[model samples]
Target: MKLYGIKNCDTVRKAKKWLEANNIEHTFVDFRVDGLTQADIEAWLEHTSWETLFNKRSTSFRGLTDEQKADIDQAKAIALMLEHPTLIKRPVLAMADGVMVGFKEADYQGALL
Candidate 1:
C-alpha cells in the first residue's frame, strides 16, 4: 500500500498513526518532496471524482484567483493539482484494490480492514 500527502499535513499524520496502530504496512510518499506526475493524478481520478480528490478548502486552492477557479473541468482541475499537489487533498491511499482520497477512520476500516 502507498499513502500520498504532504508530510506536514495533520490529516496525513493521523492516517499514518491509524495505519501503524492497525498494523497496516504502507509506504508514504510526501508530495512536497517526492513530487507527483500527471499520470499519477490521472490514475487517482479513475478511482474518485475530481471533486472528491480536489481539496477546495486548502489554502492553495483558496489562494487561486477567481478566474482560475471558474468553471473548472477535469483537465483544469488536473492542471491545477499538478501545479499544486496540496490541492489534491490528504492521505490519498492507493493499493491494488483501488485509490482512496482523504482519511476517515470508518471508511478505512471498511475498505482496508
Candidate 2:
C-alpha cells in the first residue's frame, strides 16, 4: 500500500502514525516532493470519484480564480489537481483493491486492523 499526501498534512501524519502502530507496512509518497502522474490519478479514479479525491475546501482550491472554480467537471478537476497537488485530498491511501481519501480512525481500523 502507498499513502499519497504532503508531509505537513495533519491528517496524513495521523494516518501514518496509525499505520505504523498497527504494523501495517506501507510507503508514504509526499505529493510536494515525490509528485504524482496522470496515470496514477486515473488509476485511483477507477475506484473512486473525482469528487471524493478533489479537495474543494483546500486552501489551494479556494485560492483559485472564480472562473477556474466554476463549472468544474471530472476532467477539469483532474487537471486542477494535477496542476496543484494541494487541491487533492490528504492521506489518499492506494491499497490493492481501492483508494481511500482522508483519514478517519474508525474507518482505518475497520479497513486495516
Candidate 3:
C-alpha cells in the first residue's frame, strides 16, 4: 500500500500512527517533499470523484479567490489541486483493492484489515 499525504498534517499523522499500531506495512509518500505529479492526481480521480478528492475545508482552498472557488468543475478542481496539493484531502491511501481518501478508523479496519 502507498499512503500519499503531507508529513506535517495532523490527519496524516493519525493515519500513519493507526497503521503502525496495526502492524500494517505501507509506504508513505510525503506530498510536500516528494511532490505530486499530474498522473498521480489523475489516477486518484479515476477511483474517486473530484468532490471526494478535493478538500474544501483546507486553508489552501479557503485562501483561493472567490472566483476560483465558484463553479468548480473537474478540470478546475484538478488544476487547483495540482497547484496546491494540500487542497487534496489527507492521507489518500492507494491499496491493491482501490484508493481511499481521508481516514476513518472503522473504514480502515473494514477495508484494510
**Quick one: best lDDT, which candidate?**
2
lDDT of 2 by residue, 1-113 (tens): 99999998999999999999999999999988998899989999999999999998989988999999999999998899899999999889999999898999999999987
Ranking by TM-score: 2, 1, 3
What TM-score does model 3 achieve against the real structure? Answer: 0.95
The Cα RMSD in angstroms, rounded to one decimal, for candidate 2 relative to the true structure is 0.6
lDDT of 1 by residue, 42-103 (tens): 88888889999988999999999999999999999999998988888898999887898888
Query: Considering every candidate listed, which one attains the maximal TM-score?
Result: 2
**lDDT by residue (tens digit), candidate 3, 27-76:** 99998899898888888888899999999998998899999999999999
After superposition, candidate 3 runs with Cα above 4 Å error: none
lDDT for 3 in candidate 1 is 96
TM-score of each: 0.95, 0.97, 0.95
In what order do the candidates fall by lDDT, top score first? Answer: 2, 3, 1
1 versus 2: better lDDT goes to = 2
TM-score attained by model 1: 0.95
- Give the total clashing residue pairs for model 3: 0
